[model samples]
Target chain A: MTQSLPSASGTPNPCIELSNVSKSYGLVPALSNLSFAIPEGGRYALLGPNGAGKSTTLKLLIGSLRPDSGRVSILGSPPDSRAAKAEVGYLPEDALPYRMLSVRENLEYIGSLRAVGDLKNRVDYLLDALDLREYERSNVGRLSRGNTQKLAIALAIVHSPKVLLLDEPLNYLDIPTQEKVIAMLESLQGTHLVSTHIMSIAGRLTDSVVMISKGTILWKGAIDELKRMGSPDEPIEKIVARMMTGAI
Target chain B: MLFRVLKFVLRTRFSRPFLGFILLMIFYSIVISRAIPPTGISVIISYYIVGIVAFFLAMSLATGGVMVMKSDRDFLFTLPLSSRDLSIAIFFSQFIAYGVTVLLLFAYLSQAFSSALLLVDLVALALTLTSLGTIAPSMTTKGRVSASVLLALWTSSALLKFPFTPGSAFSGSVVYGTATLVVLAAATVTIAFRNLPHVELDMVKSMVRSSSSEIKAPNSYVGKSPVSAIYFMNLSNMSLAGRFNMAGTARYVSKRVKSTWVAAIASAGAAAYVAFILIAYGAVHFSAAPLPAQIIANVILGFLAFAFSQSAITYERIWLSLTSLPPATYFRNLIAAKVLSLMLILAPFAVADAALAYLGYAGALASMVVVAVVIPGFFVLEVCWAAFTAPIQVKGDDMLMPAQFNLRQMAAAVPLVAVMGIAASASGVLDIALIGGLAIWVVSASLAVSGGFWNSVVSRLTESGFV
Candidate 1:
């Protein structure tokens, strides 16, 4: 019953695909001739160093940017199409909730628009799960950074989207909250594409890796496969550092 | 301690320009005094003191008066400076800077420094200003004043009334006023010095999270269908717009406006303007009201409209969340909603004024119809222009870009002027309505085509990292 995808393994048609897609801002090129795909329900991490076009790639996938050339599709339609938008839940790096809205209000507004069935129950569940009940009525502006991050997470998953694109999903959260978020995210159903420089986050959240550097996919495969690419006794991080720096 | 404070203040160069400006004005006053009549001294001195106080108050408010105190506290606290020196340093710097400014202003009234009592009063006034400026940032009040023109206007309005002047120098009112200022100055300075270690940052953000969270806002195509009740429920503050379903946009904006009380004041001012028109035309001797009053009323309305519409253009952070909704639907509703709120705020007043004044109900209806044609029509074009030009900077680190050259605004103004020209040339209300209807078609068509244009601009804005 496995779906076919147009990736390196040649599974069924990919849930997400970029075909020779390139994007740039002014003269500063972000992605060049970049192509990758993820089969339906694939859990992959987008790995790169700083300035490696990781953010730009996620933005393109979310239809926040149009590729300068070539094509990008999510769930078989254009990334910006209504179908794609409905299914995609994104947590941008350092995402901010609406400062003026109270915590419960923010959750309700997004949840209602997402048109989740029994939205009140779902919103209530998220509120309890995130330990946000204490400050539910307080404006997001008054919340501490960690609480704001929690609210943002709640907003992202409000729709129970089928495709989750997270950039540093655990950012600004304390250790206990991080663990809770990890567990909560693990429980969701989707093709999860997490972009992070932190290997621990990647290792825990995803089984497959799409290692990119200089806006191009350098290596991509199972996490175990990525580990084996290093020397016999070498640590995985050193291997990633080498690959990112072109020392591999 | 005095020398050290002076040296430190001088090294900062903060006071150099202020001192220099006061000196230059003083020199001008000295030269001009010989030709000045003594009779105007009372008026001139009154204006001078009030002007100087307002100039500094507005500036202090704008800067939050935090930079100097923060810099000094951080710099000198680690050094061997005592709290006394710190307070004195802060107070003296403030006192001397403002004292010199007032003295120079007073010079504009008289050829010399006036009297010893006047000098002391000036010192008290300057000290009062310094204290007021210092304590303001601690209140951590919310005032989103980014517009320079409005700031200047607010500052100048301080001269509208003054209780005491040099004319009343020996009067009891002058003594009481001076005493009150002195007491206030003393209390604020003491409190500020006590709480020098703690200062709150002015971090007031937008109270309106969004204009609307509706999945669909009505447009010419899909909007032809009836709206659901859920659509109205999502509106943050305002009531449902009957039939048109513009409530979501109006409510969100109205709520945001309520949060920022400046909008409320502007609206109230508009109401007062309406009343004045009613009173003048209906109750007074005049056949028609003065041109200045109408012009001023319109200016206030224009200001409110601009202020009310600012959110539509400056939705940088909100843009990310709004992307989930259909762009064309949201923006169209947004433009319509922005203009609707302005129309709601202002049109009633204009209509009332027209009916109550010499023009009567026909003129009122005519004006209302013309406004219906013009306000939303022009605002759609203007909002699109403003959206591309103005980028709301999210707090921390990033600096807001100065207002950009608004080509779309200039382009939009052409049709507005054309409509007004037609109104001027038209013989009757019917003629104006006919011309307005023609303009509406053009504006509606532009709004329809503007979807692609807005998408392009938003994409560019996103790429530029404004959000």
Candidate 2:
């Protein structure tokens, strides 16, 4: 059965939607009848423990993987459709851009492909904005992991996509870069779904949560609602862990 | 403890198929040795043996050395065993891994040598070869290339009748050759043993040093459209030679150079080849054309094409590329870029073939057509076929373990083998080769530009876990 969350801002159409979506790797199911939607300009975290189908859900939303049994869409269009693909940007977990290409080349190439207006200017903006200006000429293979993550983040939003899906966006980032990324993501005016296991990243970057466990949605609501579920001095992580393990 | 560790290393390291293949090769060698007459082996065979040995030595320096699986670092190295004992086990493992080729390569010479001293020579030769492989990982790229060049010169000197060369025994200087082998083997083994325990450190240092120093300026995308950006990127930055192993193991490859340089170097080589052909057979009066030379040239070009095809998409982050453009538009442009880069190399050779044909060289016309038309077509077909037949997600970086062997890798060779067969057959006949070449070009070009064809390829790649 499909499970659709109430729109946070009550927009009729979601920018990203997956309904009754189930995916399996060989005989092992990664997503089971999973359904979720984020309304236009809604910000949410797809939160779960390791191997709880967080990455799989993101891949499906990005149209890189097909759902075995349900529908996946970006802005009412199929995820792989030209319209949907153009509007969505993705940063996979542990993202690796072209190793032989330099930092600026990666940004410029993807920028060109996305048909960004004045690609050079856009690439310059990204390079400066992400603190990648110093390393623009360096090969991606030689960059530190944190810098690579910065380049990847720059790539995901290079076209100023209408919807962005990032898996472990903050995985390799240092604290300063993390704050910059969180600030940048917060300032963008589009739907954002960040898939991460860290509750602090979820709380800082998104306004709501979609908690999943064992391939199914366990809970969904505003962050305030999630916070109220805990007693005074309770870490949000404890409340989330309780729900994930069914101790709620 | 030493024996127990050695037994465990051997048992865990070698797969059943690997052991089976080695046994089968040994049995085959023995049968051949028994069948050949003592004097029937040609002297020319010695030249081939020298060449093969040089090639193996150079290749070991290029992409191989002692292999320590990640498992070894994670678990085995943690044990409280003696470093000397562990090194000995690893040294023996490296010996078996790298020495088998030399053993089989020389096995057929067993009947000719006939003396008890032949056993001594074979053992020494294997050790010399194994030592070279074992010492390679510790050397810098410049050092490896220098050593390889020196080895090439040494082997070539054998063809010039250097009395103490490794190939000297096959060429009938058994005493000098045996002496050389024993002395060389002992020196190399000493160096190899000294380097064995530090293989991990050397590999990391080499990888980091190589990556840091070899940066090229990013190509500009200022005026280029999206598809052409992809084309130029693939054209300017590409890897021509790489190592692929099975079981999702990482790939190690030669450094990436501008594909223009690869094509330029190839064209320069083709020019040299043309000069050789013209000089070998008088330019004015060419008789029954050089079928063997033409076939060899085509096979080499085909190999380059295959190499480019395999590495073409290895750098592609499908999530990025596919999202930027439609799959059809993206792949079509990607294939076009690779095909055009290949043409830069093939065009020079085709011109050379045309000059030969105009001079009335037999079969030169067919060879020219095949080079100019058929090969690029075959490259397109190969890229498309490989997406479905043996699609493996490319390993992300060089800092991973060596690739494993699997039967599926063999399937990737089918197209290259077929093209080689066609090239061989075409070398003798003009009409059939021309017609076949034309048909292939038409079909391949049509498929390359077809949106539907690319969609199917994208579907297949997605299903295969390439994303």
Candidate 3:
């Protein structure tokens, strides 16, 4: 029953690390003795079924939730430490910005807090890049869900953080916006860990996958390696499902 | 079928702690009836009752909607029950929802009225409250506001010694007042029942109309540093009326008006209140001091501060705020900004206090200190205390949903109430009020500024699922 995970990446240094981490919400275990790492600049997906602790892992790395046991670090610093927080950008699942603030204000407020240089220019750049210029003055409460998602994405990368942690980043986005976001995320130079249930999203956004089930690692490897587990024509989803359910 | 649905709804919607709160209120009412002399009920108390009822009626009309959860929308609305039966069930649900306020209002006053008359008035008030709340959704916003204003004017007629007004029964016009309320309650309940089935459709219409209306551009915080941005944004963007607890501690973004407007309105209200004090005690009872006015103003300010402070962090997204700066730095600035915003609202009252002092009221100087320095300082402690205890995460929009109250949430409110009690007791004494308020402010400021304290607070907040 010892399922092996390949070494995190070809690169040597880990920008994000979780060592023997275990977490729970009351009696329900989220992650038990879960250990993993993404090398510096590694782009990887934390793939899992619902309740497989994907979000918890991300929360732990972002320092919103502490593990019941073991260690979590970002860039070799404690995740909650200012140094690590400075280096990491995060997008929570179903994220809502300040309802009272306009889109432009939200960006500028957070940008200024993060000490982004020439923040007004940075905010303008983000508005234009994300096609949010038309609605930059719109209150976040009034934006359509897709535009809100776009704003959330813009907020995540507003400071050009060195490590991005995105949970279901494509959620509520249109196909075109998803493509735009994917391209935007790909163009950014940093390590990325995307937590998602969609296999296609994993394949598209990241080269490698860390599959988890019931709060433990089920398998971890490059998506190509995962695909090779089945016949060439097998849908990546079917392959992922089989592995997730222990049918493979 | 109606009975079945009512039973199901109550069982599902009423938490055990809320039931406990109701039971406790009943017990406290019994104690109050035994301890307090009922001789204090007089003509002035009757006018106060009219004001209280009018306030609740306006509130019910302004914020009313059927309490529908996503689950209820999916299942309860789609049920096969007859429309009449379903409507009755929803009406009863709304009654229970509004009954908490009724219970709180009547808990101490139950000894004043005869049991039979008390029962009649209680039933009448509860029925009117629930009926207006239920009927509100079917009316347009303009219609609702106009109706509320007209009704308020009519209600205030009772102050002129009008017969059969809702407050007239309490004002010593027993038979006619009772008759009027009974008829009004019957008519409103019937209308509410008839309108209940159309709530979903009306809600849709109202939402569409609201969304399609022109949205005014909000003020930009464009080149300001983070601290100033937090300060000004919290000041200008937030509304005293917009903050409500029904939706897991979220604020209504649509209700926001400029802080200048809020300040102006508040000043006018403060002036009116001062006028009321001068008219009642100064002009009418020339021998009596305005001690009650001073106490009421201070206590009211404290209560409003507590209410505003609840949303200080409830609407915050940790990923955005905390990750941008260290927790201590972010929250210290956040609390300071909120305190400053509260102080802006307090400025008018502070001016009112000074005016009161200039007019030679004995305790007005003490009241001024409480308003200017004490409450704003208490505001800082209140915000940090809320973050420490009962930091509820606000998810997506659920403005129409009823708040799921629990004992823990009730516990979180107790300390503030206790502080208000202290202020009420010591408001007449300047040295005690000033020293006590400053002591609280110093302790709160020390805790707020400490990096270690914030680290622990952030940990607790995350553990409580504030993310």
Candidate 4:
């Protein structure tokens, strides 16, 4: 129903694209006539209130959910197509990583399934990068919440996914850990679409914001543009709060 | 406030089909009672009613974990509501959900839906609840050891033991059980209030950090090759390690070996006990044996079917893990891992039972073959259908069916069951029947897969919502 970014001026095929997409579970509609496109290698933050379809959007991109109507494409092919799914990585909000599995096992299993090149090196890199080395032998069910989340993030990117969809990725982390995650994400290449209610995380990981309310795009623009619109002194959260509640 | 929570629980947890099943079971119980001549016999009727309810509660608890201990600490712990109020609300919600079902079942069995048997049932349920309360607090902790310890302690308590046996509680001693029940329930309530403020959000979601993990270096076993990282806990089945290239397969085998060892021990014990009875009676002959004996053996084989299939369905966790593997490979590995685990666990017992029994070793060998190969392989197909369609809610305890099933699965299963059930019926000749039955089921299952049913199942699994 709305376009959040400027009209496309470059390549016609964006890395991630959803055209007039809509999906509903039972009587409750999740995404309604949603349309958005992220150019190849774009980094964007998805903002919406709880149940505003941020997770739904990510699921659609990863082929976890088939749109009831409209289309979802990854790298110019259907999201569910083998080629598209192979290139996508997802971190579900709950991040249940086979509770019976140890951290290293989960990493290795997902990495091999992903058929990532040099699978061993990739698992090793993630185990080290995500700070999950210590609990590598412990069952995921035994890990602390922060550790589980780290394992989840690791699993998502274990194959060095071409497109990453992360939802509330910073939830439950200590401040220092949050900083490290942000720094790591900033260094990664490829398209990253982060969904979070935390304004600070949005500001740090992405320069563009795609804001939706009640499952439809409410606004899309540069974060700087959003900050500028709030009169030179207004906090961006205030502007976001108003926009999310339809007070804008 | 408590009622509000109860409403939410009922709305969320009870589905139309689940409620329908409960009603059907109640009606079936009632019809049987009326059809029989037990109306005039109060003792028989009351015992029947009490036994049924107690069995349901125990079975549900053993399988689903202690329902009475359920806590949605997510919202309640953070709310302004007092711990006492929260405790009452949580207790009553579980009470109405499960407790009411017991009452309804008892009432239906007595024909009037309100005979004097209900008071006994209520007392038994209350004792069970309080006993659960005393042990419930400990289950919140993870791992098998803590639970086993608590279960041992609870079983040893006289308060729990008195009422659970069939006729004792309904006799004169129910009052003591009732009083102990009240005291325990009160103590549990006090604990709940004290702990509510201190409770944390169940999600210990410390979203991981980008910082290096606590371990300074990778394990010595791990090298550039991922397979070298293979290791296991004391409970694991490390035997299957060297063969599979799939890391998922390795992970699966390690986890399974823990339960497999336990199953093997239990199966061995049961087999030895049965074998000794057979050796003593001098009736080792299997085929050409009485019909009941064959039925008894096949029932165990049926359990193997239920167990293997239940474990194979991954519920909500396999979506990402299996996303890249080809459909055929995924299904293949899934079946292999599940069947292999069952055979490894049960094969020794199968061999021992067949060898020790007076029945010719050939019959024992044949029965064991059925247990080791036929059931596991066929059940895996049954599992595929169940997981794809209406899979039963897999719990820690065994249900009539491990996962849910729908019309398609039921339709698929009927022929297999009829063929196997009929074939396994022949006295002493069950092994012969089983072999033939296995061939038919395998061929049908293969056709189901080749006919695009397998793909549909896979697609349903990967794209479906949380289990």
Candidate 5:
């Protein structure tokens, strides 16, 4: 559901905001003073190549990782604050559900923990939607990788979180499931940031694009603006490659 | 190419150190064996039986090792090599690892026997056993099952040594010798070649493919659980305790049931063994005082408590998602759940001890107190130490360095040790100390449960790039 509008400040207070946030690991910086905003109900893609701070950025937003410097606020609350977390739903990179738990049990356990409203119904809906109904009773360890990933996704969205941060949300999905998941994501309205390397995923899941390279923000604008940066005949993938490599 | 592979395998830190250590141990054992005078036929027969048993044990371990090797077989198989080449490479590679260990044992036996015939027998036996080891992993697709079966067989054979030996046969006389060696070697080579063709490189690619499937969708859960708030707050400094969401919490509770049941069975089995040992000792020495017996019982119980406590936190490593929750909430839940589980495991023994005490059995009351009070105290102490010291990481599988050998961990362990020690010493009044100590621990733990500690840990984790 779309979030209610904030008080009139003309400066639309974003549900999620990063101001000059930088994070470094030893000698290598993963995120370099990168700043961006996802307004309440705004769907944005944090597009980048491998090691472009996409996962790192999502981690910061979800309070899984702290910025080395600068501020990260989720819904105007500190990332580590309970209020911020309560409003957020995060699907980590390579989301791993408890292996020993059955698919149904995994859903029930996480659903109950999230204090999900009508948890059984929610879990059932996810199972049906993800086509995990057949494997519902099977242990996650025994289930194929695709099934496990499906369960992980179901766990992430079971509660219907507000400020959602997803990293490469459709990595292992078949083409049909990908379309279904894309459709499912498109139907949801909230402050969202999806980090992905795929331009097509970015186009399907988000309206605005935030392109980052070597831990720094290279560009931030509408998807149309990103497309406009390329020649009329150019594929968006080539344009993104040029931007990422600093050739354009 | 073969030399390069051999050099790489030999040069590994584990390989080099392992080889050196085995050689040193062999030299020491041989020197010790030589100092003792042999008792002729009986000694020779004993040595022969021991050698055979050792060979079997080595074979079982090698089989398990082959399974470990097979788990990573796809990586080696992908190097543009033929199946025969791969099989030979594996045979040589394993020969280096297991061969070094077997050779050390052989060298030790050679010193004792001092016969060229005995030395030849030992070397041939080790090589045959080592070859037989490769058969299990080569035949089975499931490494864990094969390894477990081999381990069980090895353990049973070791345990049943008396029944297997031919009482009158001398060491040099051959019964079923050369034929056994030939069969073992032939089987090993046959299995290796049979399985080599089926070793698929796609295993590695499939493994990777399966792992990378789940990607989080943006804006999925916007409003959900209150616990998610706690999970988010402590996300960076993901404590093991904090990871407990509803599903995790349920699993945590269920785990307690499984662990407690296992512990109860183990405790019962141990109690029976200890009874047997005590009975055997009493039979041998009828005049021994009850005080010495009590002391021995206390020491064994003390060791059991400490060992059990040490592993309690480590066991929870599998349920790492609980780290996503807040530390305070998670720790409290975990400690409470574990305490309940510990009580369940210890309850039967506590009852048995109490019954014995009622019947005026020697030191029964004290034993009961040790089992009930000191054991649970140790459990609490371990949980606390694990919570404060070994904070969980988000990735779950992050290799935890010994939490920088800080004064806090040492200081925490001291009181835990001291309390358990005192309880063991006090005996019947152990319950009072357990209750008092737990209250004190809970209060002390509260003081260290600030958000600052968690924040600093989270920041350190973030810096380390683990989250």
Candidate 6:
């Protein structure tokens, strides 16, 4: 994968940033003063257990939900702002596409909305890369969970957005397709924050990891540094579990 | 034991609301009965018999299918009870619910019933309830196709009435009703014992197949053009399109007016041609031409315009998928789209009327003016009513599920219809100019009210987490 310098040092500043953002539903807090930042061209993983605010964080970044306190900015503006949304692409957890639409129709429809350049060619490339060539005419409702995930991923990246927020991007995929998707996502030139529990997915798709628990950040650093914290030959999954549940 | 079963039934979240709603309906019927004369004794008896029969038929159709075909059947069949015991339990539970409803209705309309008739009613209700419970399990199957076939058979049997009328066929009633109830009960018990296990296994297999298949990769396709620019524009307009664009507004208004003009013109042209034929042929005495004919033309034009206005907004439910979009964007586009669509649907008819007037069809021209001037006003009133009172969710089978309606929502629709009717009536006595001026005022007022209504409703729905 090609490497690019962190854009935060430049005059335009970072592509996405969150400073102590907190959100809650009634008595249950979803995100508790969680903070993170991704500069332009940064590839990072957001690792946490279920209900650890992984989905909530992505929703905040995508402007689907507003933070109860603190701040979240995308490309230096509020997440839903035209300029911010224009540069951002998001795939929600268990993302559901328009069920009535066929695969090709969904791609083209979203492409038109985003005003992507050479829409047809871009859609074709994504379709082939994702290996969704045979069920193009099928309604999305009829597609399997794995295929639905593929279509959702395609939709998120259709605009070739500058800031991408993906929740469980490789969910429901077989091992081989997961590998293919990691490579495909790595090839894109943009800032990416992928939320997942799988350490291997984090390691392959991103260089850095941000571990969170109980809606707060537990650790943030390189994947290599996280591995070094564990004893030699210790599985990364155990390490992640320890960090998430605060066992260590 | 009965109370325990009732408690179990009520414990289900769906059942409580359903039962409560039915009770409320029964209460409302009682209130209405006080105002109208009590239906005669014969009619009351007939009503009870029909209600009992319908209740049994409903139970047999709904529960029988669920018992035989559903996965829940396994749990039910495995319970420590004999088939006869289970059938009796099911029968009484359904019977009690139906019986209570009838008792409430009779209490409210007490003046209509005699002691002998009430006894017969009770007997019929008991027989029907038990019969349905017995029959339901036999007719239903695990598969949808089989269930449908069973339903068709049940429906045909219910519709096939006996030769004796309610009061006339005493002997036939006794024989037919008793035979129907006994046969249904026997068939249900037989079927319940035989089909229960096979259906349970089939259900398990189907569930497993569905879940396993959900993880497979879908086949893809290539070489298709993207969706049209217009489709995207419509989607954006419905979902994310910001406050009004001047270009979009002008295009919409022009389109609306052009179509309405076309309709108006077409009506006028047809009317003028008929008038010319009447004049040329001297088919009838001119003095004999009824004045009501002119009024009829005016009413037709008025109704056409009213239809145009109502349909403009109603069409959005199907054409635009507004329900899924962001509320502010959806409302804005809805207002603009309806305004345009109405103009398109009604403007031609108005223009056609004016053209015919120019061609010496005075009556037709007059009707066209009534439509042109009255329609837009009606459109605004209807739109406002719909904006405030029309339920946000589209009517479908799912909507039939329990829902609450507020008093304010129920009242919101009243004024729109009333005001339009009053305005149309007033148009008859007032000078044409005065009526026209009033029409414009009503339309403008309705439009403003509608805009505010949309904003309030949208905000509330969003805040409530309904959308």
Clash count for each candidate, listed in order shown = 6, 1, 0, 18, 20, 28
For model 2, residues A1-248, the per-residue Cα lDDT tens digits are 12233457764777788899999978999999998888888889998888899888887777667788999988888887888888899998878787777898888888888888888888888898899999998888778889989999999999998899988899888899899999999999888998888888888999899998889999989988998999978999999989888999
DockQ of 4: 0.15
Query: What tens-digit string does per-residue lDDT give for candidate 5 at B5-75?
Result: 54443443133333454457778767766775653434544555554444354434332233122323535
What TM-score results for chain B in every one of the models?
A: 0.49, 0.83, 0.89, 0.60, 0.49, 0.38
Q: How well does chain A score by TM in each candidate?
A: 0.94, 0.94, 0.94, 0.93, 0.94, 0.92
Candidate 1 per-residue C-alpha lDDT over B1-467 given as tens digits, one digit per residue, 9 for 90 to 100: 76786567544524344345445777886767666655533554555545555545444434323224334445656677665665666555545433445555455544332444555555555555555545555543345144223443543444553334322232224564455556655775686676544533211212122233222222111111112212332232332111000100111122332312443554576567666755665544333333335433433344344444444544334324444655565566555555555565655555554544444522334444444454445455555655555444333211221111133322322443544444333213546655665675576547545767666766765765644
Q: Is the docking of candidate 4 incorrect, acceptable, medium or high quality?
A: incorrect
Q: What DockQ does each listed candidate score?
A: 0.21, 0.56, 0.47, 0.15, 0.18, 0.17
**Residue-wise C-alpha lDDT for candidate 4, range B1-467, written one tens digit per residue:** 76776665454434444455556766876677667544433554544444453444333232222222114444445668656665555445435334545444444445532435445645445434433422333343343345434443443333233553333333333555445434544654565445443433221111111112332222222232322122212123321211111100000111223545566675776576465646554553434333344345655555545544544554326446444544555555545555555565556655655654444533444455555556655666666655666443221111122112233433433434643564354223555656655774676367445625555555465445541
**Top-TM-score structure, candidate number:** 3
The TM-score, computed over Cα atoms with residue i paired to residue i, of candidate 4 is: 0.69
Q: Where's the lowest-lDDT run of ten residues in candidate 4 chain B?
A: B242-251
In TM-score terms, candidate 6 sits at 0.59
lDDT of each: 0.58, 0.75, 0.76, 0.56, 0.56, 0.53
Per-residue lDDT over A154-176 for candidate 6, one digit per residue giving the tens place of the 0 to 100 score: 88888787788887789998989
Residues B1-467, candidate 3, lDDT per residue (tens digit)? 77888888766666677666667777877687788776556666777787876767666766566655567677777878788877777777777776455655565666555545766776787788788877887888889889888777777777787876776666667688778888989998999888887767422223322532223756665667767777767777564432343211212323456777878888897898689777777754423277778788888888788777776776788879988778888899888877877777788888887887787766777778888877887777777777777666544555323235565655667667666865776567788778877887897898889888887778778777665
Please give the distance, in angstroms, between residue B96's alpha carbon in candidate 6 and its true position after superposition.
10
Model 5 chain B — which ten-residue stretch has the worst lDDT? Answer: B245-254
Instruction: Please report how far candidate 4 places residue B182 from its true position, in Å.
Output: 16
Candidate 3 interface CA RMSD, Å: 2.6
Docking class of 5: incorrect
Off by over 4 Å in 5: A1-8, B8-75, B82-85, B88-133, B138-264, B267-271, B274-324, B335-467
lDDT score of residue B53 within candidate 3 = 68
**A55 in model 5: Cα distance from truth in Å?**
1.3
Which rank order by lDDT, best down to worst? Answer: 3, 2, 1, 4, 5, 6
